[model samples]
Target: MSAAARAHNPMPVLAGAVLVVMAAQQAIVPVLAPLARDLELPEWSLGLLMTSAAVMFTLTSSPWGRAVDRVGHRTVLLSGLSLGLVGMTGFAIVCQLAVSGVISGELGMALMIGTRSLLFGVAMGAVPTAAMAWVAANTSTTQERVKGLAQIGAVQGLAQALGPASGFVLAFAGFLGPVWAAPAVIAFALVAVAVLLPKGPSRRARAAAAAEAEQAEAAAPSKPLRPWDPRLWPVMLGGFGSFLTLGLVVVCVGFVVQDRLGYEGADAVRMTGLVSTVVGLVMVTMQAFVVPRLGWPPWRMLRSGIPLVALGAAGLMVADTLVLVTACMAVLAVGMGTVGPGYVSAPTLLVGPAEQGRVAGLVQTVTGSTFMIGPLGGSALYGINDWLPFAVGTGICVAGAIFVWTRKGPGETATAPAPQPELAPDPS
Candidate 1:
């Protein structure tokens, strides 16, 4: 196919890839408790495993993204898939050996923790950076790219719903449940990459193509300048706050749901799925219809989302009734759904094509760090009072919103021209 044709198709593939990876990653979170018990590790230590992965993910994102920019998405994505496979295999082996009446106590726990962390790091760090860059490069219009991004989140929600639900079943089946399942997901992803992701054009080749396109478009008038950039600090800060809240909630949602709402173990798990599914659906609805028609400014989304998330914290604090808490969860979902697309789209809109991978990695790393902090912070506060952490979490979200409102940044308004759409067609 021609260069133009290649660019036209890559965006959809990018979105699909992201969804698949997210689904696989989230599938594990719900089952962590069981996995811990089965592996004979303490529940607290299992929590640490989750935190360790986030730290690695945050720290590595920028560097991996930069490398993607230098090399290509194909290389970076494949490397991530490989890491996932290794991690999953490690997990399976550890579980199998442990269940077979081998590797008792701390030794078994250590093995599970270490391998799981490594897998989490690779999965979290690589997927977002590569996928974001891939979409940015392939899509020709900002709206289309945003649509693609929204789809990724939607898929992530779907995955979140499925991962734990399915994982619960798999865990009981045996130690190899998540482990064997992980490889299957990775294999499927590999196929998607092969069929969907276009080979990116190299720098030397792209320069030649741009010169030709410039000559062709010279007679056409320039497009209007987009005012606010999406990459501004406010958007990133807002996203960090949002994810931080999510990480914390994901960690403690079971306890909160059970104690506050009169839910038992399995019931709490189901509720978690319901909340995630609801959020996913809401996000799909908003990004698909509302964002386009209402066309509220990105800042408005940020402002609104923060307060809604705060409401979730409040819901946790009071916990008077199941209905009340459920409403709060929905409110939080709306807030995140409102603001998330803007944040996801910001850096791509701001940076040049060459920097997409690096910037994406950096952003993921930053976001991942929030994931680490949220759980740790929540845990520390949870010790004081069950409600304390949720209360404090709400306060943090409110503060983040305030910062967004007062701050001047990209996505605040449509002042400057938004960055141009980047196009690269592979010769191969």
Candidate 2:
């Protein structure tokens, strides 16, 4: 079907799915320490749950994207949802079993790593890969691509905000209530997607996309852009530094509240929730309402966002009070809100449309690698000293800022940014 004939923008549906998936994933942040204690496992081991997922995503995302390019988004996305449902449900069951002493702590942790982390990780990777590839394939200009990718960033912030709120509310039922609810919500989304989502990219749309790529590549034929391509490296480093810095702070935020602020268990969770909500709200507002209006180029956005991120990191190092921490997190959120669209969409601008799937996978792979290193690394750093993680993070952000400002990545700076369009396209 033509873009004009289409009844809905599938992007919004896809974004909604991401929002749910992320909300479920992030809900565990508030409960990680408590759950670890309850299960008689070392608290640091739980970070493995996240690290495992990141490892799987880093390994599998490229294959997943290639599948989307070969077949279509519907299959890959549905499969992701199905895998996530099964995996997350199994995860909740194991958590319940361990809580009841039906399984040993070691055994429970192992099973959860399998069901929740490893399996779920692979599932999570598929969502953004397909969604971004779909977005990159459809949009013809950099601004359009950034606007589309910013939707992904906005939902992630919304999820970050929502995750802890869900945890706080669900804690009334039981500690496990939020965990159990994740699959149910995911299942509902899966069915909605299976029915409402279009079958795949249509042949006509594909041809139009290819024709567009040809026009864009008239000076030189498009080749599959590799991660190591010199043209892509500056973009990669900027993305890597931003996420790595983020990882250093994110995995430690809850613990900081618990230890430094002398809040225990639910209080710590609530405090952490407040911080996450503040940051999430900031990110959501900035990406959704502000970024599009400004319509800055990807390079410019990256350049502008980095110093703010560094300052946020520096602020986090000194933030002892709950108010101070929340302010620092909001600062970080604003910087990331600026950085994410540029980081995510810049690669699409560097290559022709034919390589959108590959480039999208590469983009996610870089981010996923940070997820692997960030959680475990942050946890370990927090174990040593509360401020060390943020200090390190501050350094990385500064370095990223330096690189982004000094380096000239080809294609991104060469073309003037296209004029901003409507907030979003009306696919209806």
TM-score of each: 0.77, 0.84
Candidate 1 local lDDT, 1-428, one digit each (tens): 23555545665665566666666666566555444445555445655777887777777776776666566777788777777767766866776687677777567667766776776576657776776655555566656565555556566665655665565566555534655686677778877877666676677765665564455446344442221224455667788888888667656665565556665444444555455555556655666667668666667777777888888777878775756766776777777777776666665656554454445555555566787888767655665677877787787898987887787656654543354445554322
Clash count of each predicted structure? 18, 0
Model 1 regions lying over 4 Å from their true place: 1-13, 37-44, 69-71, 95-101, 140-154, 168-180, 191-231, 257-271, 320-325, 345-362, 402-413, 419-422, 426-428
Alpha-carbon deviation at 98 in model 2, angstroms: 2.4
**Model 2 clashing residue pairs (backbone):** none
lDDT of 2: 0.77
Query: lDDT: which candidate is best?
Result: 2
TM-score of 1: 0.77
**Full-model lDDT for every candidate:** 0.64, 0.77
lDDT of 1 at 79: 76
